[model samples]
Target: MKKSSQPSLLNNSEQKAALPCDHIPIRPGNFVADRIFLAKGSMTTPERVRFVERICALYPEAQLVECPDTPHNRIDLREQDNLARHQKGKHTLVFGEHKSAVRFSAEEGNACPNYWHFSPYGFCFYGCKYCYLAGTPSYWHSPAVRIFLNLEEILERIERVANQANMPTAFYLGKLQDGLALDPLTGFSGVQVPFFAQHKFARQVILTKTGQVEQLLKLDHNQHTILSWSLNPPELSERFEENVPTIAERLEAMKQCAEHGYPVRAIIMPLIPVKGWEKIYGGFVERLLESVPIQRLTLGGICIYQNAKALMEMKLGKGNNISQSLDPRSKIGDGRIRYAQPLRLEMYGHIVRTARKLRPDLELALCLEETKAWKELGIEDRMGHCNCLL
Candidate 1:
């Protein structure tokens, strides 16, 4: 079967095109492209042109494929052999997949929740050292922000689904990109929140590591949207996270969201092991209890994709030697790697116990784990969809 070559598309009713500026320089193996769509507020034409021009100059190897002004016929660009090169440690490309409203599930899974992930932007701007996306096919350059203008149609489908389902259905917003990071530029939440707010059966969750909560706070959040934040200890943030918000800032944002009566969840995932991690993580848990009234907390240990194991090992280098020493083996599908099950159980057990003591009513769960682990912890009853239910 021939692979479908549909480029991801978006509604761009608000976008305007600028004249081609100077040619941006690119090294031998880098592929880059940019398009200017109608930005929400105060985005001048010259500024947009300059931003595109600057990026082209920075990545000269990239091809500036211009997208159409009309909703249809937008260019669908693909990386020819650059992905293979990224496999080799050479040049990187910023590949864009312009998806339409009905076609949004890009991950590898048949059981993908029938949720619309309107990824306007292709890659994340924040450079977390342990970012899973970075290890995937997209991390050829400093993550670029690609916005899908056709969000209106995506929301329309969500509404249509909500009308059919009498019971509540949850949809995630930040799966492909930081849900709120691009809100300042796109104002997606302004449109999305109001749309979902009208549907009694629909609940929207926007997750992010960025602390740009002001954009979301401007809207009326009447328990329609749940603003979630991914969290880690200061030690992990400082050592592993790059170009992201501080833990204090994120927690403060959570406090603000909770105060506004919006249900908020915290995800302490990709839990990396380091020296004195127990002590540091314990303190971090204490700080979280003191900071906000968390609606739910999800725990996850490190699960590396097969392709990223080498890159991750190189990135961690000497810092992760301790983790390498206590290697534990487990398999998920055909993928397998080392994450000591005993150690994972021990670490997660501590977190679950501590969090339960801190907030007895706070819902707690794990991200992606086997059912046996839940049974081992004696919390099988709490496991549900995505293991975020309690």
Candidate 2:
């Protein structure tokens, strides 16, 4: 039979012109890079050249090194001269082509609706102790922040994949890095928010822990971009999350995005069970719902691979409650350690009940959890309502 000439169902949106590459703006502050390493092939495109020139203008003194391989090679180079020191803050900026810009989640039994994930940047500036990327191959090499200059090609890849798929799909930005952490420096939101806004079949959902929303507030997101924030209570934020935005700042950003007509969501994941967690977390949830009209709220607890667990232990010291709390006897679908089933249930249940009472209309879901957990939480019907999906 001949294939149908019709387009994909989700690909029915009108074609929109992309924002001019030269018009993109940057809000460079203390987050400027010390040096930049560019892949030789990236400079061939005009868009790539303009993006590089923009960065060069911001940090005139930073050295620019052209690598023989794509910038991905520079990030995968495990033997940086001063590896330990570079991971602190004195990091290098590497921009290159993203060869395979879109792919399905390789995670096993991740309850989230399977969709494509692509990042304009990788390995965030905010170094949370329990970062799951720590266990992945990239962390083994270098955790320095990376920004890709070939965004035009990346967006084209998304459009092509969405046109080919049968159902509606979303391109997630937070899986590989904190989506918006360095937005002030890259001004990526200005470009991406509008691209997705115009695309009919493809949608963009960004997740971040940073409060950098100055540029986002001015964008015409057109409801196609969903902005979500990773949050924790004040006590937990002060303890485990260092050098990241405070809860107040993140909540305020969420409020601004919601007010600007952007679909807003929150992921209260890696919900740690520190002492007095129930009362503390319950109160935190109450205040958050009161301050913002959140469209969705997802809950999750400690989920880590062995290597990531070791990295967290090394950074936080061996006796850290995060690793100690995991059930070591068995591994989950993706070979990651997590809190015992009962503990996770209690933690997820607490926040769910607390938020439900305050805002019965709010959508609640889980992250990277298994089928049994979803059934236990009685949210099996809402399985697809995750951070990565609409």
Candidate 3:
């Protein structure tokens, strides 16, 4: 029923081979959609129906189903949770029409000046060992990745919310999902890039671990969007990260975004104090600063709730580096578990010292640490300049 841009005749094998080097591929992302579903309101319009059909076309052999109610309401938690830790993105799925997609974070006590975040999608598909979203009840019930079909309304809601603010505020997209992971398949960036580009008073911030920026490269963004990437060294990645692009690929993608005039930032977060971590991270910082034109670098250690820590234990054994590093005094800060103050200080200090030696003028901030930690690191004044804020 389509005229141009029909489904490709090539099969899965051919498609994988066809993908360019310098990138990693993921199912439930980047064009691999073996399972697809249409929610109650996904196909409300003929145009939307056509768009769904186009997305289905990319996965010619995928099985498509139509859900009667909400996408997660009917899913079984056992299977989805099992997959959450054992095999993420194994059988890629696409759920449609997320009704509640925007919210304001109310994090307090950790020196967090809360910000408004919105998701064009829900539930990231990448398999990271320390994924805090895995513990959330919303994602626990249905671990499938979702794409919202109500963009027009979402944008209108954003306008109303942005209008509430007297000054330009950022609506972040990486809170509940990797902002750009599904972009290669759904082409949502084409919608978001232009929307933020022309919005009256809202600026956009997005983060991802994927290396697919071909869609981003062709857009005409008027500096309204800030592109960020969550990163760890390849050594750490090999041990903890799965079903995502490599660090090299992500840096390459970041470089491309920077050259294309998108403000680029990096969050070297959940820093694991593995054996020889000092050398590994030190060498990596040198390479990162020398290679890319970064606007800012935010450093952080593992921060999560107890429920999420249980999920991490499931994926990684109880004796893992992260689990061993967790502060065991039973004193929780801001309702989230974290590395001890001294350990966090040591890890963050190493990165800060390394970065300062290379580029003293480089902008840096600590992510989700307490005020005292900031004061300890001598970056107390850079508190609100985090990844999500303006």
Candidate 4:
């Protein structure tokens, strides 16, 4: 599909488009979950009960369990990271409530603008081989995917934060989770998109790998929502990304969103330096620029927490390219393991130049690198435009 400079259809109305979801996403992105668990007090309110019932109906075949005393984040077993176990647990879905969902970023040292973010969904079902969430505190104990039932309260918190700010503020949805991975089942986008469209100052930004955008094409976004995808070249994705959509498939979805009048953006992130990387990456960047009408393009390399790195090595072997490439000298500013400064500079510079040479007008930014690195790469002034930022 070719991209148009202007949106083919205006989405600021209730009019729906006859769009197809040709993209396959996540790990069984259209998940028929193995089991569904109702957490403690998950059915307290009528609204909460109704939402649970709606999701449960979608997976009538899934086993349903009632957890009377356990929170959704906690489980009785330690979910092992073996390939077999990792894929198995990803299908486990839990229903719970997070009373407070809005939080500010703490990435002060890593050159981040400290954006405000929220997650109606907890954990991810897409089991990437190098998933950083695997090592985070929330997912370490239990890696099962969850849907937060207190969405109304979460939206209220977001509006409260937006009110505190004098101008338009963005509340990110994919910081802790792939924003739309489970949207087909939860229908969260149908709720959040309209909320942001009708609100005065709140803008929604969703980062995702899912291509089930039928709900988005039908919504009245009013140009208030920004959809970004975590993209990698198909070659590298095959090595790292498991059970996620291909680069071409994501670009197709981006084209549809652009045609339907939604602001689109992408991140070529966690760039792995495979053999003949220059040619492969250069070609990929050219295709990306020529394929989608993206407002911004962000680039980043792998930044793995120690625990996450350990788990990654388990899947890719101790001598994997990613693990071997880590700068043994020391960790970077964010205290995450990364390639040597020079190697990162080389990779970032190559991709940046490739993107700029094709679409110099395209907005650019770096994700999760030190301030000095950005300055050296000559894009320090454009730091805040990265994925999930305003």
Find the candidate with the highest lDDT and give its number. 4
lDDT of each: 0.58, 0.76, 0.76, 0.78
- Tens digit per residue, CA lDDT, model 4, 1-390: 322232212243442221112222232354658788898657887766766776677677888888858888875444454445556568888888876578998885588788899978888888688898878877776777888877766777776677667468898988888898887776667768877887677899999987778778988999899999888888888889877777677888899999999999998878887778889888888988898989998888788888788888878898887888888664766688888888888988888899889888888888888888889988888877788877
What are the runs in model 3 whose C-alpha is more than 4 Å off? Answer: 1-32, 72-74, 77-92, 330-332
Off by over 4 Å in 4: 1-30, 78-85
lDDT for model 4, on a 0 to 1 scale?
0.78
Q: Is candidate 3 or candidate 4 better by TM-score?
A: 4
- Cα error, residue 274 of model 1, in Å, equals 1.3
Clashes of each: 24, 2, 0, 0
- The TM-score obtained by model 3 is 0.88
Worst 10 residues of 1 by lDDT: 23-32
TM-scores, all models, native as reference: 0.73, 0.90, 0.88, 0.90
Candidate 2's C-alpha runs over 4 A off are 1-20, 23-32, 68-70, 75-90
Candidate 4 has a TM-score of: 0.90
List per-candidate RMSD values in Å: 8.9, 3.3, 8.6, 6.9
Q: What lDDT score is found at residue 27 in candidate 3?
A: 31
Q: Model 1, range 50-90, lDDT digits (tens) per residue?
A: 53455446544544444334222122233334333333222
